[model samples]
Target: MVEFGALPLFLCVMGLFSESLCFVTLEVEVGDNVTIWCRHELIVSGYIHWFKHTCGSAPLIIGCKQFFGSVPSQNCFFFNESERMVVSVQGENTSLTITAVNVSDTGLYYCSSTDLMRITFHETNYLRVKGSESRRQSESAGF
Candidate 1:
């Protein structure tokens, strides 16, 4: 199914990390791993959350797997399942990863520090998923 491409709408929301820069970019196959990045200052500590909001369908909350340590009760899966999501912390850097990419994964993903002191999920990503099998078949058969 195709949906209208709409600009990401920001939910009225930071000094951020004084000198810290946060960025989350994902690259993966249709049914492989999807990684989210959040790199910045080392002297800062903040809770992070990853969310994917489709234009039409309900937004999905990445689960406890990605928590820095423990999952926040209020931030729990109050909306959708977050099991597929996992958190990876390297030193002071924070990032989220998702497995099994799907068409539904196509949408705007947002990342924010639970403290609300930092904001960076401002980018909207439009992912287009095509069947690899279909492509292979077409290639073998030739145009």
Candidate 2:
């Protein structure tokens, strides 16, 4: 008893109700290690993308993972060539870890997925990396 023309609209409404977004703010000190975690729900065959955006800079794809059938998950970093950054996927959970985090790492990290229909943003993490004591003291003293 559903009108053909309204079926799309109904589905859109249902999707809106079923979708959820999570945001987290994190702070760390320089030389510290940090990890951002993301969980995907109801995704069977698709890809998860991790992006980073900083003030006055365009968003960049940092890492990605693909899942298809019985194939194992593959992880790669497009923007980060350094070994200090790593991306790993285990079941429905994925994490991006940064070693010896510094001020340049401060930015917004986003976790999104694509199912060939639309891109769904799952989480946003705002990372603030503070300098060490000596560095902070020197900068404040203008040394």
Backbone clashes for every candidate come to: 3, 0
* Model 1 lDDT per residue over 31-79, tens place: 8776666543323434455566655556665642223333332334443
Task: Give the least accurate 10-residue stretch of model 1, judged by summed lDDT.
Answer: 1-10
What lDDT does each candidate get? 0.48, 0.69
In candidate 1 the C-alpha lDDT for residue 92 amounts to 46
| C-alpha TM-scores of all predictions | 0.50, 0.69
Question: Candidate 1: TM-score?
Answer: 0.50
Residue-level lDDT tens digits of model 2 in 43-96: 577887777877567678888877663566765433433487777777777788
Off by over 4 Å in 2: 1-22, 69-71, 76-81, 133-143
Indicate the worst ten consecutive residues by lDDT in candidate 2.
Answer: 13-22
Q: Which ranges in model 1 have alpha carbons more than 4 Å from their true place?
A: 1-28, 40-44, 64-81, 116-124, 132-143
Q: Which one is best on TM-score?
A: 2
Local error of candidate 2 at residue 130 (angstroms): 0.9
